[model samples]
Target: MMGGPSENPELWAFLESLHCGEFLSGTVTAIERFGVFVALDDGPDHPVFPGVGFISFAELSWQRFEAASDVVQVGQRVSCEFLQFDTWNLEARLSLRATQPDPFQVFADGAAVGQKLHGRVTKLAPFGAFVQVVDGIEGLVHLRELAWTPVETPSDAVQVGDEVTVVVTEIDRERRRLALSRRKGSSEHR
Candidate 1:
């Protein structure tokens, strides 16, 4: 929920002028473990933070990264899409990735079910192993699909960083989900 605007009428007016999904440009003023702050070129100065624009860690990039600094640095110019007004902080919640192309969308455009893809096992879970089919795209090979024979645990068949071949079994663009099957790739696979 949006809190009341600034005490100053001009600040409130500046905040009022903003709309969600609108593109905005700013110079990054600060980079924290939590997020990046940007000083809006056309907006009123923030009363507290270095900038009035805030981009959360999840919105920093489409690609997987260990830290925010890995995606951006202080003093870098950025173009972001306004997500919402953080009334509590009196700042604009922004998305940096919105200004860039979505790797998933690009991948899904040509991706098709039954297509065989080579990927690396990134992580193992009770139900399946996640395989990176492409940059920023990971598909799950369910436990049952691990092999033609019974698989008790994902680690038993695959380990992280292990390169494996898998067949695309399903794709849900709305959910950003991709399902892969090791068994379908080849009957010889373990």
Candidate 2:
């Protein structure tokens, strides 16, 4: 199988010139369960594709959506941040979400420790439950913080979808993480 250098020399040069985080404008060529394809306004003809830019489902948006079409449509114009050169697929790995505002950053900017907020438990893990404190922003409610009493499992404290009151115990903005506590009170109550 051909593996080393790109068979399409022109495409290789174009890809190399593009750097990560560079903005590219394109028309949405196709949308599927996996990703959305874009026909870049720049670049040489793709011998086999109508488009040469790809945005995986995870890179489509910061907000949860039912499908790729929910964020973009065929023939729709879009601006994406270049992520990497996909040698395997000979496509530009791009992110639509990177070009948009991050809800986590915005929330962290205004949030503080010990503040209380109502959130819904969206997922359960062996260690804790992930709660959506705001749209597109979820934080971990550690097993130890599930309650004041000792808890063996996350389910024992709160099941998924439970509306619970939690305290913002920590906010690590550099790591983009929000540590939450499901316990009734802050250290003041202890």
Candidate 3:
């Protein structure tokens, strides 16, 4: 038998009263490729579902990850910031990552220009190569900064999955961007 709002007036009433930006506690009920569903405690039953709250993949964590399971598991308890009422689905839109400290902020706080760090190249583009200095933290090595020699493309100096030692060229905390260089010597290069 399926359960819904009509069958649980008390739960539905609580859900109906929830406003945006509220904080709520819930247990992860399901993890789909698109999002995670949560059975909110002290909340009303969803009009047509088991879970009263849902978190999109982008809201799962501040860090980039491969899957939803990497941030949360079924039955794991989580505290989330209620974003809005999903009127179409009769579910609460929540953000689990909002409750956690941003890893980028942490990395920015300790990082500085001209500091050399070891990283792994994650992607290659015509403009630059993306290297991960830490899990979820990546810096771009522009084609001009790839090496002392002139380069036509990022691949000329670096390839994806290559381990690279890069010097921080710029850190834009507001934009959450770290510019890195692999060149032998430049103003910001080590």
lDDT of each: 0.89, 0.86, 0.85
Q: Which of the predicted structures, 1 or 3, would earn the higher lDDT when compared with the native? A: 1
TM-score of 3: 0.81
Candidate 1 — number of clashing residue pairs? 0
TM of each candidate vs. truth: 0.93, 0.83, 0.81
Per-residue alpha-carbon lDDT of candidate 2 for residues 76-134, written as tens digits (9 for 90 to 100) = 99999999999877788999999998888899888999889889999999999999999
Best by lDDT: 1
Better of 1 and 2 by lDDT: 1
Candidate 3 structure quality by residue, lDDT tens digits, 108-164: 889988898999999998899999999889999998989887899888887899998
Ranking by TM-score: 1, 2, 3
Error of 3 at 141 (Å): 0.7
TM-score of 2: 0.83
lDDT of 1 by residue, 40-71 (tens): 88988876789989999989998889988899
Alpha-carbon lDDT of model 1 = 0.89
Quote the lDDT for 68 in model 1: 86
